[model samples]
Target: MATATYQNGSLSAASLQGFVLVGFGGGAQAQALLFAVFLAMYVVSVLGNLTMIVLITRDARLHSPMYFFLKNLSFVDLCYSSVIAPNALANFLSSSKVISFEACATQFFFFSLLGTTEGFLLAVMAYDRFMAICSPLRYPVTMCPMVCAQLALGTYCGGCLNSIVQTSLTFQLPFCSSNRIDHFYCDVLPLLRLACSDTTLNELVMFGICGLIIVSTTLVVLISYGYIIVTILRMRSRSGRHKLFSTCGSHMTAVSLFYGTVFVMYAQPGAVASMEQGKVVSVFYTLVIPMLNPLIYSLRNKDVKDALKRLGQRHSLVRDGSQ
Candidate 1:
């Protein structure tokens, strides 16, 4: 049984200590509005990602390295949004934003894992594009089936390993005082702030590992794009250049949106955690990006558009033949 102590008419305890007074820093109306917005995003995100998965699986033409990575990206977006959107919606509806300690830890764990995986996977995709465009002759052998599989597996493993370090460090803190988390979800920064124990070690580990991963991946992506631009610039024929540009434009836009939001939200630690700004930034990266990824990729890709049209046409032709 959990013990409750009364302090100034507020019930508190060390056991369910973190589940005390809901969110200490937000209004009910605001929470409800935010919830509604995210609910729509969650719906779209799920449907869009599912559609991509179905399209890719059914379309034999999309069995190449590029589409394989895209399928994985869609799957990741589904899981990434699912981790937070449901709990966020629940928090908005319920009077208590109280999540159990174990639940909070689990949420943080998976969120960290998925987020890291996405960062690395995007970089891997950039490298794959680099190889395809900058070295078209070697694209086949360079990005072979086995190599693609290994890259995807490595991305997942890297994310999981980083998350294990972060989650373990986060939970190791001793909570002797206030337990109210300022944010809707159990984010590392906010959760660390609530710890009565010294968080220097945790912060160090968090910063060191996450910083290395983000910085290294960003650098690699930049260099890869640099080579790609040079290659594009070297093409003699205007039509050829235009064709290459069109092929890569959709992917470039996706990368820009994904990396831009993440870099803006997490690349720095300014007045965000203390003020309302962090929440807004978090919304972009956590909620909005996932929702937009599928739309951006599918709507922009020629292959996907063609596949959809073909699927519809094939269905219609079959029906007519049957008639």
Candidate 2:
């Protein structure tokens, strides 16, 4: 157990004081409201992503490369939302918002892992679209079942490796400083700020790993889409261009929201916790993005709408027959 005590301008590492997690300094009313809001978000995220997964899995008509990647994306979104939302909701409801040191580290590890995996997944999806549009003749061969599976595996593995390195380095330094985390979750910067020991190594590692992943993934997605745009422009039929753009609209929106929020959060210099502002930004990526995923994809997708209609008609017919 790490004992926490304040000594002058710095924290004393000689005594190990256990840490507690205090989320958003607010009273009972605020906590209750916050809890309700997070609970609603968690429910929506779970239901939305799960519905997509089930629909994609059960619908034989959706047995294609596109839907397969969508199914994978939904699964990733569900897990990603679950990793942070429930714990956040718990902290919001409780007056004593304390998380064990081990648990906090675990949360960060899994969150980083899933986040990196999602980045890779999005990049891969962009390449899929590129092949489909830019080289239609090679699309089927390029995105074969085996190739898709390998890409998915690589994304997961890359995410896991990145998380391992980041989490290990972040926690290696002694957190002899005050255990008061300014944010809702155990993000790298917040946790790093509490170190009783030096964190130059941690910061470098954090910036390096995060930057490399974001830059590499963004570059790949951009290059793939660059070719895709050229190919779309070459098509003489306006309807064909529109159809192609529409198919990619949902993915593009999701990728923009995700990468945009992440970039704002982690990319800038001198970007520390700004109390209320930080929480709001965190909400965009952690809460709002997860909730919006299904809505963004399904609302714009004709197949999803058709499937829902079919499901509703079947239910209606079943009710009439039962009556």
* Candidate number achieving the greatest lDDT relative to the actual structure: 2
Task: State TM-scores per candidate.
Answer: 0.89, 0.92
Compared with the true structure, what per-residue lDDT tens digits does model 2 show for residues 1-323? Answer: 44456666565433434456667777788888888888888899999999999888877787778888888888888998888888888777666668776788888999999888888998998988888888889989989999999999999999999999988887666665567777888888777778867787777777777788889899988898889888888899998888788878888899999998877777664564575676788888887888898899899888887887877887899999999
Q: Which residue runs does candidate 2 get wrong by more than 4 Å?
A: 1-18, 317-323
**How much lDDT does each candidate structure score?**
0.79, 0.82
Per-residue lDDT of candidate 1, residues 160-233 (tens digit): 99999998887776654566776767788777766666788887787677678879998888898889889999
Q: Candidate 1: deviation at residue 115, Å?
A: 0.2
How many clashes in each structure? 0, 8
Question: Per-residue error at 128 for model 2, in Å?
Answer: 0.6
